[model samples]
Target: MQHSIPPGGRVSGFRLAKLLGEWRRRGARHGSADLAAAVRMLVLDGRLPAGTRLPAEREMAEALPVSRTMVSAALDQLRAEGLVASRRGAGTWISLPSGGALVGGADTPLVGSSMVDFARAAPPAIPGLLPAFDAVRARLPEQLVDHGYYEHGVPELRRRIAQRFEARGLPTSPDQILVTSGAQHALALVLRMLTGPGDRVLVEQPSYPNALDAIKAMSAIPVPVAMTDTGWDLPGIAAALRQAAPRMAYVVPDFHNPTAHRMDAETRAGLADLARRARTPLVVDETIVELDLDGDPLDGPPPVASYADDLVVTLGSASKSHWAGLRIGWIRASTEVVHRLVSSRTALDLGSAVLDQMVLAELLTEPESGLADRRRHLAGQRDVLMAGLREHLPQWRFDRPGGGLSVWCELDAPVSTRIAVVAQNHGMRLAPGARFGAHGGFERWLRLPFVLPPDVLREAVRRLGLVAAAVSGGGSVPHQEVEVPVA
Candidate 1:
């Protein structure tokens, strides 16, 4: 195939050489699997437009200083995957399948059927949950022989949860709490009670995608405010409040999802003041506050709720701190708001499972409950995982978050979806960054969960490094030699 360099451009640098070396190494070890996966992802994510001509094998190999054989293998793999097609004297070109072509046909069912998913933000169930369940079963006969299923949740559970919040500096009363199945359910009920179709609500950019979907499903418009690496963009948020005049602002103030940036007390107070001034309700998701990985719990500032008033709707859950299977989460608000939510919840489900509520109450009230141990375990795991990433892929940029389940890493190039696809082929599922964004930005980011065991995390990062090198066009070399760009 004949090729010419793009006008006013020339490719020559150590960067080019490193990219080629990385690609070659990945091809030799993984046999063009990663490169092909990258090509397919580029097509799938619309980064490489349909009919875009690919560089010739010999030219790419020469430019990158790799063997033509490796380039040929990569091209062949792409051809086999139907992502690219070659014609006589035309070289290779991308071919994107239309939306209808994604499934077997237009009639194929693809919406609700379960696909291999790594996008969920919740953590795996803890081992202690089973014992808690057994204990609940043993004590159920005495607790539930006389029945009362009302909206205030189980009395014992409410008191225990309120006490836990109080310990964190968020004053609460049993009458102000209403338990729901999970955090998502709680958020849904709150939205149902507070807002309606055509109402405007504020959300953060790269916010929880499922929550965005929920808002859309309810016919509400979501106004996005940007979040920075340090924390919430208070100026931008205030501007959005003024411009959008949203009915409510949903925020993940503690150990936020996707970015793991916690809002400081000053920002929290400022936001509360803004909400109060604008007459906008603020919904705070504190689901991950108990997952702190840095310092002793005694060192951190008071909980976010300590800075807000009746305008704030604080949501907490046992899912992240304890076990997701427990399906126990609660909303803390004024008594009036609690009653409104409870009344609205009656149409959704009769009540949360009595057994699970009782189990959570018992667990939270335990003198030596499992929270401290779990925190210690998570802290150890986070260190191990971060160390692995630093050792294996130094080119990527990431923040060692204070507390959260995942690390948000930014790749040197906009090829994270490709890397995820390649990793999945090697038996490692990844959450691509675009899944976190509202309008499909963040193509250069990926979320890696550090909640896995150290050994498993090591393996995952090793495979991930291999994938990153391949996408970066770096050929075979030790991970230490790979030039991963932090920016």
Candidate 2:
């Protein structure tokens, strides 16, 4: 693939410090190595993209409150690794992150590679998927009679999606649905329609990594409200909505990503009222709501849109629910909003893949038990993961998530970035907690996906234990350059 260099942009010293959160390890004498490791992780994660200019050592030292000598040492290490480059007059900037191919855990094997993809919280296609495809193939003859373009999605698929919402206790119509390439694509359209550069978007403190990337890419600021131990902090969200007066609020109320917290009905009602009062549309992401492991998704709390339909823009995807290969997601909102989105969407693409939409529509027609098998499989894998964690790394702690695909593990030490840096050698790819945070500070947290097979999950956890132990022991792991994919 051809690449275009991003225009050089300089990051502020204080901003850089925030991005490199909690870099120093506990009881560590020298912070230089830790600082370098943190920076390396950020660059590899695309947090600090190539062509991004860095603050001078003295400025960075003032922001970090570390000695200039330590700052110089960290820069030296990064420069030696070629992760960063500096010139006499040009100062320092990030080098392009390329070369050194590493295997990734793509569900369908995107390439010839081998590694446990612990970062992506996605599962393979369900057992019913191929049958759904065959069903679509049988009906394909008539579908070929007309032009395949569906700006508002195939009508039957849209109706099926609306029916799912009704099952979840939300009154949705086919008019409210506008299908797109994926949830990420749906989000981009919403952002383009509702916001402009410098607009504020309310978001959870630790959000979906790609969502955060989308918000930043749009040049809109993210106003984050921290999550409590139990779930969302409604008061905090209300305060942000009032003070920030953001253009819109992006939320994952159902089986929230990484943390896997589902909002209660009462809280959902309160949030809807808050958004209504503030006139801020809540962009609710229910991409993984169908993956409810504890109970039926329909039996779960009512869809947040039910509370304030006009104040909500719901994004749904078949990626996590049925298959990522489908790449089909849709937006549900007021008909006016849907129409506006369609007007703006033509600049992006014509419509989602017709065949994929048909497959999902077919799957949606199946009984609720169609997804029961998926939940059971995930629950069993979750059990395998928790058991492995207890056996190999008992010190790590995480709450049993009732739904969603991952376990949010809290490390005994502030070494998430360290653990990730070392895990590559163990043939495991892990997403550090910093990826979830808005400005990067969850050093003690890591999100571990249980989407892999039972045996793979068990082995992944075992390797993770070794990685955690190595980092905690303060033994230096040799640098192994590889790409870190964010899902």
TM-score of each: 0.71, 0.76
Candidate achieving the largest lDDT: 2
- For model 1, state the Cα shift of residue 165 in Å: 1.2
Q: Residue 121 CA error for candidate 1 (Å)?
A: 4.2
Candidate 1's C-alpha runs over 4 A off are: 1-118, 296-299, 474-487
Cα-based lDDT at residue 105, candidate 1: 11
List per-prediction Cα lDDT, in the order shown.
Answer: 0.69, 0.82
Q: Please report the candidate that would top TM-score against the real structure.
A: 2
Q: Write one digit per residue (lDDT tens) for candidate 1, span 218-291.
A: 88998988788787888899999999999999999777887888877788888888888898989888888787
lDDT string for model 2 (222-286, tens) is: 98899988999988998888788999999999889879999999999999999988888899999
lDDT of 2 at 317: 94
lDDT assessment of candidate 2: 0.82
